[model samples]
Target: MVPKAFEAGYPKTLGFRKVVKATIYVKKKEGMSDEDFIDYYNTKHAQRAAPILQRHGIISYSLTYHLERDRKMIQDIMHGKAQLMDYDAICTFVFPDYLALAKFLYDKDGAALSSDHDNFMDDKLMKMMVGDEYLLIEDGNKVG
Candidate 1:
């Protein structure tokens, strides 16, 4: 669910507001040596990462793996109204302002997160980060 404030503020901030989404894809190394990557992401990493991001003013986000239905949905969105073409894991952020988002992405914590992921990720894994503008289809979508 989206927060009341975000619902009220989104439209007003539409032109001024900025939303960022990043996708990270993981692949294991040969001989199953990199299986730990999956375990880390599915268990500890996400939980650990969430609080850190929250501290940086990330209003909402989620981590997801690719599924058949997800592929279909992405195809539909790309071919349909929204022309987004690429992404795997989508992390959405609604900051108080654009600068906050920029700062958070460039800050020490953000850098550490990036580095940590890179350090653990196998060379075979294809990781990428892409940014995009988002429309809030619903309010407080991230808050539980």
Candidate 2:
């Protein structure tokens, strides 16, 4: 179930304690190997964005690369035989709230980070969205 704070169209303010999670779907540029893409994003991009994220009220950031073992699942989905999951990587970020996210976007730091995306991935191929998390399970146990 969706949390009350995240129920309304606008995120409910709870002393800036609620986190706004942004899920980013990324695609590497042409000729870039998967290893290289993951390396640059996890190391170079993340390193450079560390301070910028802190300044923007981001509490955490994580990158999940597509694994070789998951290739079959991806192909099946792409071929319309399975669920949708067409992305090379998933980058998750937790922010203090939506307002902070907005401030980050308008700030020069945000612009710098936006430009940095060109160095490792294709902007035209990236997709991103922000939403709150709902905990329906924990450590193999259901929590509803």
Question: Would you estimate the TM-scores of all the predictions?
Answer: 0.48, 0.74
Which regions of candidate 1 deviate over 4 angstroms?
1-38, 67-88, 119-144
- Give per-residue CA lDDT, model 2, range 1-144, as digits (tens): 443543323444343324688899988777788788888988888888778778877878888887554677677767946554667788888876776666666888667888888878889989988876665666999765
Q: Would you give me the overall lDDT of model 2?
A: 0.74
Clashing pairs for predicted structure model 2, backbone only: none
Which residues of candidate 2, in runs, are more than 4 Å off? Answer: 1-17, 67-69, 72-84, 139-144
User: What local distance difference test score does each model get?
Assistant: 0.53, 0.74
Tens-digit per-residue lDDT, 11-104, candidate 1 = 5444323454445555433343324545666576566667667776776766555434566787797785654433333334455545555667
Candidate 1, poorest ten consecutive residues by summed lDDT:
1-10
On TM-score, the leading prediction is 2
- Model 2 RMSD in angstroms: 5.6
Models, CA RMSD each: 8.2, 5.6
Q: Rate residue 23 of model 1 by lDDT.
A: 50
